[model samples]
Target: MQTRTHFTTRLAALVVAVAASALGCSAQADQTTDKIKSALVSRLGIDAGDIKGITKTPMAGLYEVNIGTQLLYSDANGDYVFNGDLIDAKNHRNLTQARMDELNKVDFASLPLANAVKVVKGNGSRKMVVFSDPNCPYCHQLESTLKSIDNVTVYTFLYPVLSPDSTAKAKQIWCSTDRAKAWESWMLDRKAPTAAGTCDTAAIDSNLALGQKMNVNGTPTVILADGTRLPGAVSGDRLEKALSSAH
Candidate 1:
C-alpha cells in the first residue's frame, strides 16, 4: 500500500510539472509575439492595428506576419523582415502566396448581392462578383473577356476610385432603369449611360467603402463563387477553370 501511494504521489507531481511547463511555454510564446509586434511597428512604421497576426512558420525561428491581405516574413525577434514568396523547393509550393490567398478569401454567402448590378449569362449557373470602375481600362478589358464566358451570374460593384468622372458614370449606370445594360453598353460598346443620375445610389458609396475595407486598390477585381480573389484581368479559360473548380 505504501509503495502504491508513493507511485501515485510521484505521478501526480509529474503531471503537475508537465502542466506548469506547458503554461510557461504558452506565456513565453505570447511574450515573443508581443515583442515581435512591437518591433515591427517601430521598425516598419506600420500601424499596430494593421498588424493582424504574427505566427511561427514551418521554418525554425521564422515568423509569418499578416498585414491585411499581405504577408511578410520575420525573424523570431523581428530584427529582420522581408516581403517575397517563400518557396519550398522540394515540394514546388509557394507557402507565402498560399497564405496570402487564404487570408484574402471572402465569405461568398456574406456578400451584399443587392448592392450590385446583376448580369446573367446563359443559364447563370455559376456565380462571380466583380469590383469595377467605369473609367478603368482594365475593367473594360475584363468586361470584354466576360462576354465570351457564359452560364455565369456576375454581380458588379461600381467602385469608382479613378476620378470624379468615374463616380459620375457609375452613378448614371446605377440610376439607369437597366443597370446591367447600361454598364455593358458603356463598357463594351463605348456608349455612355443616358440616366440623369438622380436616384438613391447609396450602394455605390457602400461599395467604395467595402472595396477600401477589402484592400481592393484597383478595379477589375474578380471573385469566384468559392471566394477566391483574382486581381486584374483574368483570361476566359482561366476564369472557366476557376469557376469549375470552385464547385
Candidate 2:
C-alpha cells in the first residue's frame, strides 16, 4: 500500500510539471506575438487595426502576418518582411496563396443579393457574385467573357470606385427599368444607359461600402457559390471547372 501511494504522488507531481511547462510555453508564444505586432506597427507604419493575426509558420523563426486578405511573412523580430508566395516545392503547393484563398472567402448566404443586378443565363442553376466597376476595362472584359458562361446566375454589385463617371453610370444602371439588360447592353455594346439617375440608388452606396469591407480592391472580383474568391477575370473554362467543383 505504501509503494502504491508513493507512485501515485510521483505521477501527480509529473502531471503538474508537464502542465506548468505547457503554460510557460503558451506565455512565451503570446509575448512573441505581442512583440512582433508592436514592432510591425512602429517600424512598418502598419495600422494596428489592419493586423488581423500573426502566427508562427512551420519554418523556424518565421511568422505569417495576415492583413485583411493579404498575407505577408516576417522574421521573429519583425525586422524583415517579405510579400510573395511561399511554395512547398516537394508537395507542389502554394502555401501563401492557399492561405489567402481561405482568408478572402465570404459566406455566400450572407450576401445581399437584392441589392445586386441579377443576370440569369440558361437555366440559372449555378450562382456567383461579382463586384464590378462600370469604367474598369477589366470589368468590361470580364462581362464579355461571362457571355459564354451558361446555366449560371450572376449577382453584380455596382462598385464605382474608378471615377465619378463610373458612379453616374452605375446610378443609371441601377435606376433603369431592367438592370441586368442595361448592364449587359452598356458593357457588351459600349452603349450608355438611357435611364435618369433619379431613382432610389442607396443600394449602390451600400455595395461600395460592402466591397470595401470585403477587401475588394479590384474590379471583376468573383465569388463562387462555395465562397471561393477569384480576384480577377477568369476564363470561361476555369469558371466552369470552379462551378463544377463547387457543386
- Write candidate 2's Cα lDDT for 21-57 as tens digits: 9999999988988888999999999999999999988
Question: Model 1, 131-159: lDDT tens per residue?
Answer: 99999999999999988998999999999
Sliding window of 10 residues with minimal summed lDDT for model 2: 238-247
Clash numbers, per candidate: 0, 0
- For each candidate, what is the lDDT? 0.92, 0.93
Clashing pairs in 2: none
Query: How high is each candidate's TM-score?
Result: 0.93, 0.91
